[model samples]
Target chain A: MTASIRQMGVITAHLIRKVAFNPAVVWLIAMPLVIIYILGITMHGLFSAEFTPVKPYRIVVALPEEAGFLVERISRAPKHFAVEEARDAQEARQAVFQRQADAAIVAADGDEPLTVIAPPGSIVLEMLAGVVQASLEQEAQQVAAAQPPVENGSREESDTGARSAGAADGALSAMPWEGVGSFEYFSIGLIVMFMAFASHSAMVHCVQDRSTGAYLRIRALGVTRAVYLGAGITSGMLLGAGFSLVMAVITWTLFRVVWGNAAAWALMTIAGAASVASLSFLLTALLPSDPKGVENAGGTVYSLLAFFGGSTVPLTIMPRWFSEIFSWLPNRKMLDGYLKIVKGAGVKEIEQELFGLAAAALIMLGLAWLVVMLLKREEV
Target chain B: MATHAAVQEARGQAAGDPSIVVEGLRKSFGKNVAVDGLSFTVHPGEIFGLLGPNGAGKSTTLSIMAGLIRPDSGDVKIGGHSVIRETQRAQRLMGVVPQGLAVYEELTAAQNLDYFAKLRGIEKKRRRQEIEEILELVGLSGVAHRKVAQYSGGMKRRLNVGIGLLGRPRVLLLDEPTVGIDPQSRRHILDSVRRLAESGMAVVYTTHYMEEVEYLCSRLAIIDRGRVIAHGPIDEVRALAGDAVVLRLPFPRGVLDEAAKVESLQNTLPMPVEVTSGELRIVLPQGSRQAPAVIEELQRHGVPLDGMRLESPNLETVFLSLTGKALRDGKAAEEGAMA
Candidate 1:
């Protein structure tokens, strides 16, 4: 057993040396970091208030008598809006056309209670319309509250209505807090995606060794099959974990991204590394002893996983069925667990995701072992 | 003092029990048989040559002895360890230098040696010393730190042999180690093999080059159709062709119309005559006594003879005598049979 371990260590060390000197590996490590940096810096403003329009939205009210109430309600809302009273409908239209007002609210003489006119595709105009509608709802609620309860209606009905209103209010207040910047969120995705793809270097090495006949030479030297396969897995794990930790440190130091619960973070990193390494081993073992074919196949498979596993897009925006399928993927679980940690979740909150990652890693490793055994039988 | 002691110990171990015993080894690939009930042995201080054509199962036999493949029946024992039952021990007693260059091209020569040495379980302190010694022995000491990719074909071949010499196994197997290289590198490799045998190690060398077998091997086995057709010392195998001398008489392009019509030449020469495109080959009993009579007889027949040459028996003729075909023609014949 000691001899086996030592042999494995030596093989792993040699593989690491070979990969470190490879020019492709240097570019593989650098490309993702540069892309993340550029994307982070460029899209950082999109998630902040600074990127919003600076000028307050100007509103013109055509009815003098009701203009005061509308202006007060608009001012009380959580948006930037300036309300001005117009002398007539003609004047309000003129103000809107002249760019004095972003939108105009006129009391209509027809069945419709109000008319809102604004420039096409104006976000501020949309916000102003929402404020007007909310004010009308508030007035109707006040009027209903002042009226006596209907004798035909039961207390359950009134209670149900009150609870529904309270639930709506709760939903409005329960929006996710802006704890992490958009760049930081996307950076995690990019980092995990790239780290997973980096396992191709190990795959390429395996294929090259076989094609070059180095594998046969080593085997003839009495290195057992188990030792060789174990060494490959260990090398891949080291690469994945090493690159991830380095990226994490850089992003944290430079971008001030928060990483919560050190223990959870460590667990997630190890699980992610094991998952990718095992997957790469299985992939390389199943492929023919051709370096180019292994590389092309590995790239295609990893890219597909990255796309469907929420590494390239947010899982929340994906359809329900797609997200369900994505949840079973190792990278998805890794990203989910990482996000939870960054959101200050404890180990207990992410225990299921971590377990899923572990299970996936074991399955992949089992498949890799079977493949190695098959290859060993066919080598001679 | 320590290095000298170590060398003496290695030499003693090599000489004490170094022998390869192959018995009834059989291997088949699906419908085709690669090695069919073949066996041989090499004793210490002996360079055993495996001479055969391209598809003669020489490599298959070497691979089985190296423990790279399992035999269908029978077994091989290296220094008293059975290759099937105790593979690790058997492998430790032997080293194999494959036909192709197996050194990692991306690594420096030193690095490649270091890797193999570690795998061989050599002590770290002695590994560096052994690597340097091997580099010097292979004449690669000047470029030990250069990557193998930058090395010439001869340099790479030398390094491949050097890697096998690490840890100094009792028996060394070289499978056509000089297949593609300049003459200088070939000489260097041949000299190295001789030196290893002199140091009391048993060596098994395989090649199709008859001259190499004649020049370096102490004893040899010629294989054909997956069987050992001949085995013994150089002189004994040569004797298999008998004491016949071959004489080639070149005539004008169309002088020799048919071999059967040469009744006069056959009556005079007391041997069979074969008429080819531009020459007539005559086989006779050894000695110059028949030469003057044959020349006089050909002159009497008005046979147009431009020039004549005489040859003695060797491995190539022995192969022809055994298989009724030349060694160089074996590949083409095999391909034709397959077709």
Candidate 2:
């Protein structure tokens, strides 16, 4: 017992020296930091843009009767526009085409038929067009009422309001990126990418040690299997946490993005790393003794998992069945949980996801332990 | 002079207990039996050599003693502690130098020693001193700060020896200690072992190198097929092949006519002379006076001797007599299988 404990201390010291001083060890640690730095820089702009206070859209109205209400709604609405009125439809079109106004509303026939126009693919224009069209349609229906105008009681106004509300909901739902910027989406994807690289590299080290007779040497020193594996997971955790933090800082400095609570984020970093370490150990153990076997099997497993886990595609956009399948992949659970934490989710909000990640980590670590125990029993 | 002084000190302290004893050890790996019903005892202050071919169970026996591998059936006692029952206690009394260079390549030699010394629970104050002493003892002081990866094979082997000596166990088990070392490093290692023995460390050295056994071991066991074929003093072991004087003489012309003269010469000389092929090999009853008379008889017959080799038996003949084949042939066969 004393021998084992003393050996553990020795092994720990070596681990520190390897991670702290050796170039290979430094590179193992530094590679993740570099990725984090790159991702933080790359994704910072997107997060800031997603959450930034949106500016009002400039508009021009070319309608005579219905245009009055359109201009009022454009000017007075909570998040609609900066209002302007063009003399005619031609002038309004010119305003939009010349980039002077983001959108224009023209009243065309009796009861004032409305034609809403904006620059193609312009987010501000798209929102403004929907807003102006709703106001104009309301005014047109108000004039069509046959009964006395009762205060807040016209059936046509209520009907148009309901339709407008439904249309507004549809428009918002159509563009997912409108609410979540491209940077946030990219940041989430980079987290998974970093994990993949870290896990793969960790497995490579395991294979090297096994084949090179180093494992046998260490075993002969009375270093138990548990100590050996615990050190491995510890190394992986250090790598993952160091990587995630660098990436987070870089993300903040470059994008001016704000992340969640520091404590929550710290737990996320540790959990994420533990999950990756488990995965790396599982994959390394699954690989046959042949060097080429790892390449072949690892390629298939990585590709399939990355595809399903939203590393390459957003899980939200994937088919319902595909998403359901992804729930089974530990990578998906971790990435989902990590993204939620990074996206400013509170502990209560991400509790279920965190539990799921923890469960997967434990299962994977348990499996790795079993496999390693079996392997140890075989030869050395 | 130092060796004499150390040996004198050892004699004063040498106690009644045997250092290591193995009885009826049996171990099998899958279908192959590694050590089968093997047994031996190593007394204090003796260099006991385990000599055999590659698969002759030498390594298995050493590993069992070192507590690295569990024996299927056996009783191994180190300083009166059962290896299986009191492994840590038994291991505390022993140090093992494995066949492979087990030193960490990423660490400096001193760092490697320091790490292992700490594992062995050497006092913090004494650890550095002991590491430096072992480094100097192994003649690796100048290069102690260099990472083991930069070391030549011989340097690594020497460091392997140094680590085994760090805890200063009562018994040191070295598996091919001089293997892969340069001639200088090899000599340095052998001398270190000699020093340890003189200082009263019972050493169990396993190797296929007979010259090493002859040079370093006072007693040896010739093992084959996982069994000890012979074990005793080196001279006693070699005596299994009777006393024979080997003469490297010129090929005699009249082989059949010389046979009659050699027989007549045998009656007059103190030893019996037999001519096989070209050389006259004489088996003495046990006297040195026969050589002069044999030389005179060969001269009388005009045997025209070009050269002569006269010596008592050695391990080579002993090994051949026991195995019915040379040790080298058996080692070649084992290497072939491994390759």
Assess every candidate by TM-score: 0.71, 0.66
| C-alpha lDDT values of all predictions | 0.73, 0.66
For candidate 1, list the clashing residue pairs, or say none. Answer: none
lDDT of 1 by residue, A1-380 (tens): 88889889998888777776778777776776677677667656434444445666787877545335666787664347777888876788778778788877665333324556665324454355446655656666665765321111111112111111112222323222234456666667777888876665776786787775567677778887778878988888887887788888877887787778888888888888888888888788788487888788778888888888866654433433465666788888887788878888788878877888889889988987787667656343
> For this target, which candidate reaches the highest lDDT against the unseen true structure?
1
Model 1 lDDT tens row, B206-255: 88777789988878999887888999998899888787666677655455
Q: Rate residue B53 of model 2 by lDDT.
A: 72
> CA RMSD for every model?
11.1, 13.3
Candidate 2 stretches greater than 4 Å from native: A1-6, A25-222, A250-258, A280-308, A312-320, A378-380, B1-16, B241-339
Q: What are the per-residue Cα lDDT tens digits for candidate 2 across B1-339?
A: 455445545656445556889889988878888888888888767789999877799877877777666788888998889877886688777877877676778889998898777767788989888898999999999999998999987789899888888777888888887765567778889999988887878899998877789999988989987988988999898888775434336446465476577667667655445444455555533434556766777787666667776666677556655664445443443432332
Candidate 2 docking: what grade? incorrect
Question: What interface RMSD does each of the candidate structures achieve?
Answer: 1.9, 3.4
Query: What DockQ does candidate 2 score?
Result: 0.14
